[model samples]
Target: MDVDFRSGCPIAATLDLVGDRWTLVILRDMLNGKSRYSHFLDSPERITTNVLADRLAKMEAAGLVTATLYSKRPPRREYRLTAKGRDLRPTVQAMCRWANTHIPGTWTPPADFMADKPG
Candidate 1:
C-alpha cells in the first residue's frame, strides 16, 4: 500500500521492504512450506516470537502474504504467500546458487525446490 519509500530507486525501495535481517529468512521458510507460527519458530534461525509477529504483520501489510484465520478458540492464523511474494522465488533461488558456489559450507537446496519455476 502506502509505503514511505526513501527514494525513487527500485533497488532501494525493494530493500526498504525486505532488507531487514529476518524478513528474507522468513520468506525463505515460507517458500519451504512453513506457514504456521510454530512452524516458523521451528526454523533453525530461532527467530524470537516478537520479531516473527512483527515480520508477519509487516508482510501482510505489504501484500506479500495473506493471513487467514484457521482457528478460533485461542485464535490462530496461517499465512500464505501472495503472487507478489511468490515472485521472489527466483531471487531466493539465485541467492542459493550464489551461496552454494561462493560461500563455504552452504548446503544445496532440494532438487525440486531449485527446479520449481517462480511465479
Candidate 2:
C-alpha cells in the first residue's frame, strides 16, 4: 500500500514515486546499462509485458528516464536515466550494501557500481 501524502516529507514523496516492487528493479536494470525494452523484459525479475510498459511510462512521467526511438522499422524505444535518476545511485548502493550484509546468499554489487558515483 502507498502512503498518502499528508505531511511535508521528502521520504514520503520519494516513496510515492518509487515505492512499488518493480520501479527500483527497473532502475537497477538501467543502472546496469540496460536501455532496450527487450533487455528490461529479460531481467531476472521477469516483469510482465503489461507491467513493464506501465512502469516505464510511470518512470518517464516522473522525469527519471527518457525514452528515445532507436528503431523506426519496429518502433523500438530505448530508456536512459536522466540526471535526476542518476542522483539515485547513492541510495541504491546503500540498499545493495544493506541487503548483502543482512540477507544471506545475496550477491554483492560490483565494486565499480557501488563506488559512490553516478550511475
Winning model by lDDT:
1
Best by TM-score: 1
lDDT of 2 by residue, 1-119 (tens): 23366567888888888889999999988998899999999998899999999998988988999999989998999999999988888888889989998999998877878877643
Q: How does each model score on TM-score?
A: 0.94, 0.91
Go through the candidates in order and give each one's C-alpha lDDT. 0.91, 0.88
The digit string of per-residue lDDT tens for model 1 on 24-51 reads 9999989888899999999998999999
Which segments of candidate 1 are over 4 A away from where they belong? none
Indicate the residue-level lDDT of 88 in model 2.
88
User: Candidate 1 — worst ten consecutive residues by lDDT sum?
Assistant: 110-119
